[model samples]
Target: MLEVTLEILRFFVLALALGLFIHADRSVSYGRRGFLLIKIGFLLILFGVFMEITDQLDIPGWGMVADVHVNFYLAKVVGQLAGSVLLLVGLWFWLPSIRTMDEVQEALDRARSELEEHFVARTRELEAEVDRRCKAEAEGRISDERRRILFENSPIGITHGFVGGRFVERNRAYARMLGYDSPEEMAQAQALAGDTFSHIVDPADVERIVGQARNEDYVKDLIVRMRRKDGEIRWIRLEMAMARDHHGRNYYFYAFALDVTERKERSEALERYKRRLKGIFDSLPVGIFVVDRETHTMAWANPEALRMSGYTLDQMIGLPCREALCGDASFCPWGGIEEGVPCTDESFLTRKDGTRLPVLKNMVSTVVDGRESLVVSLQDISEQKRLEELREDVNRIVTHDLKGPIIGVINGCRLLLLEEESLDAELSEMLHLIENQAEKALQMIGLSLALYKIEAGTFTYEPEPVAVMDVVRETLVNLGGRIEDKRLAVSVLLDGGPDPGLGSPMIPANPLLLETMVANLLLNAVEAAPEGGEVSVGLEQGDPVVLTMVNAGAVPEALRETFFEKYSTGGKPGGTGLGTYSARLAAGAMGGTVELSVSDDEDRTTLRVTLPGA
Candidate 1:
């Protein structure tokens, strides 16, 4: 029993050692070769123990046999011996490793102690940093509160959100601006679209504004059209900045917006108006220029003005008007005068080639962009001046050259008339008519100069009593050939009655002028009258005497307005067009006016002349 007890005790000790080895193996790593060797050694030791335990058991037939028992004992001894050898070998292999583990453990304990000390010190420093950060956070919160108040109450719209994402926060102004009742409503809509404000923005504008934001990370005063909640379109100007995280990654976008619909509309309207005005000015034949009042520089010049001044728009802008336009500054009507004064002048302008050009200039002061300015309108009058000079030359030739020959003819006719007694009645009458016709030619030559003077507003008037009946009689006699060719029925009336004797119901006018005027009317009447057409002249005596000449053929509709104007005529071959013009001028010179009226249904034209009565 004691032996058995000893064996049991031995087995227990071996088992306990195996348990300790397993515990150690779990806590520390044994190299693969060492682990395998130790494992085999321990298994052999357990096998020896198992054999010894078996030897103690009084069991079956095998152990009861002597040979079996001896074999078992031998096995037990071999197992123990092999186990002892293997354990020693394993220990040999594992000892250095165990020593290394022990040293590593010692070093680890020392490092752990140092780490604890450092952790304690670091905790204290962290506590101080936390305290400082907490104080700073408190101050920051107060400032943030004030900023929040301002952001919420600001008149301008403010919004914060992820770019291309739903809004995280929005100010009241932003909500109200978009016609939303509250910020939450706007946010709800934004979330539905999963975008910042693209749903409200015009599609084209969204692409442009968002593209700009992505490229620049900032947008300033970008105007976009956005639809409000109620479907109204509004113009919004956005100024935005994108926020980035520490790693320069996009975080969110914050934006300021203002409703600029009214201002934008006004600006657009003004731009359109400017475009139209520029079109008109460019189309005008007259040159228009705008000059600054304070700087005396060219503010604006129409296309015609630029062309006339021989300068490009780029070259003329902001240049002094004197240099750009009329070389002499003294010609500027606004010079040396208070702003807003107006003036007109006929002056000479210096062209780019240093040639003189006559211009009729009208200048008026105006205000532009809160600054006083001058608006100058000019017409090129070179053609008119040339025509006036030509007219003067013609008048000189008629007075000096033609009059001499005409006077000599009149003297020759007078000499012939003195010898009329030797001639028969027909010869004598023919001489008298020749003298009368020659005098008329001289009178007509003088009338040409008189008509020019009347047109120039330099004619002097001298009125005398003139017999209207005698003048009418003489005009009819002069136009007898034309009247006969047209087969016209001509008649003269006094106060709607038949023509009376000569010198009755006379008018105050030049006798020669009256005769010339009457002759022009009769000629026009005879020409206008159709074959066998009637021409009637009616005179009325009142405060102002009235002469009405009626003929067939109504005036053409297109020519009626300008019929009395100089060089205006229609449908008459070889017509000088100056007959009616001269007739009107002669009437005006004698305090008279002429008007034309047409009766389309009656197919007639009436020429009415009003002259001062005697």
Candidate 2:
């Protein structure tokens, strides 16, 4: 009986272990549901352990017989203790598995929810981007359509072609201008072919056109007679230019042409009229040059005019009138005439070789091409000018040579009267006045003689190697009395060194002319300076020798333009105005220049004289 009971207990324990193993498999496969199975299995294992303990102690018959006397109470206590331990262990393992199953299920649920939300949000963003791209494409298409319409409807003829000479596109104006019903038809007609376009050109002009277009990138105002679709020939002026492609291949040429048949006929008629009008221009015998006032260039020149100026039509076409004819630094000597004042008989022109040509010019302002222009005609009066100069020279010689002797006679008579002890007081006064008038006349004669000599290019110059410093010192000493009399201070600054060379030590120039020029400058400075004002003189040697004089007075604005002109002064009382002019002329004869400049601030005037080094 004990053996049977022990086997039955062992069988129940083995069945419980099998059930727990099944429960653990279910826990892994079925999540929270499997954990409930594990809890049920744990309870059954506890029951099986109790049954085994009862059987071992023989407390109750469980279909087994006892084989030997056993302590029922002690065995029952020991079996109950073992059952409690097994039940506790199984419960501990089952509880932790159940908790692990719960955590895994919670994590899976959260991940599923987050993934679905992310998928929905991404779909919406993609849809919005697609919509934006579609809208932008639609707007771009509309703008392109409008531009195409404008291009087709424009007034100017437009065409585009490939580098291979094939027409890619053209507009309605181009078709109509070329007498085609449509641009496509005109492009298909293939009008431009190997030099056939030259058929419209005159035989004599064909070579010129082809050569010009080949050598130059553009041709303008090319008049040609082209045949129309209706078999009419019309003169056209074509302006054409070449174009290149991205690959630098020669592309089709583009041209704008105007039907100039009427204009050409009118121009021919005008030529005939001009031939009739030629008599009027040629009859004057004097040269006539018509200058376009707006361009300041020559428009037309007569035969005699070209001869006088020594310029061909090709050389003269675009040249400024003053530059072509007059070599003067300033253009148009009749100043106010350029400002719409009619000019007549005052301005002089220069020749090709820098010679002055006297002319009687008549200018009248007129409007041409909606702009101001001058109609100028010139009459050459070079012969007349020469005759007048000759007369003046003769008169000067007669007056200057005769006046000195006359003055001597008057002075002797005055001295004789003063020596008479019985002479009346009024008589002595009259004699003194006569002597004064005679002296004035003699001075004028001397000035006239000097001017005549200068004009004739007969003034004598004696060049000698003299100490430049000595010459300057002497000039200063001679002017010391005048400087004191005028109450003006004179200062000289000289760079002292061995005279550079025979040419360096002293310049090749007339001593008298140099001294006269220096004296004139000093006198002018003295007159211009206020009482007790300062005057400065400086001498320096470089590539060229330079002498400078500065005075503490401003140049009057009125006299600035004509400062070096003969007989022009700022109206200072008793001022001859010839001193500065003659001084500059004398300097120029010696290959030197005398320049007068006012300070930028207009506070002082400076005179600079530059001469060739010795």
Tens digits of per-residue lDDT, candidate 1, 1-614, equal 88778877987887888777777777656554665577677778777776766666755654455544553654466567787778888878887888888888898999999999999999999999999999999999999999999989999999887766656788999899989988988878877877665445577887776676556677898988888888899988989898777878666788899999999989999999999987999999898888888998988888887777777788777988776455475555455555566666677656666676788887888897788888888788889999989978887686768878878877887898788787788987877787787788888888888887887788899998888877888778878888888888988898989886556677789876787788887788889888999999999999799999999988899889778777788869999788898898899899998899999999999999999988
**Candidate 1, lDDT over the whole model:** 0.81
Clashing pairs in 1: none
Please provide, for model 2 over 1-614, each residue's C-alpha lDDT reduced to its tens digit, 9 standing for 90 to 100: 66656756665775677576666564374344444444454455444555555555556545243754344433344444444455565556556766676887888888888888887888888888889888888888988888688658876655554332445677886566657688776655655544333235366665665555545577788877766555577786767676755776445566556667788899999998888778777666666776676678877677767667777767666668777544455656434565456666545666666666788777767664565666666677888789988888788768967886877778697777868677788887877777766775675565556555776798655566545555666666777887888788777776643333233256777665676678778778877877788988777876478888899888888688778877877777888888898888768766789998997484789999987787
lDDT at position 520, candidate 1: 84
- TM-scores of the models, in the given order? 0.47, 0.36
Distance from true location, Cα of 75 in model 1, Å: 77
lDDT of 2 at 255: 57
At residue 289, candidate 2 shows an lDDT of: 70
Q: What C-alpha lDDT do the candidate models reach, one value each?
A: 0.81, 0.68
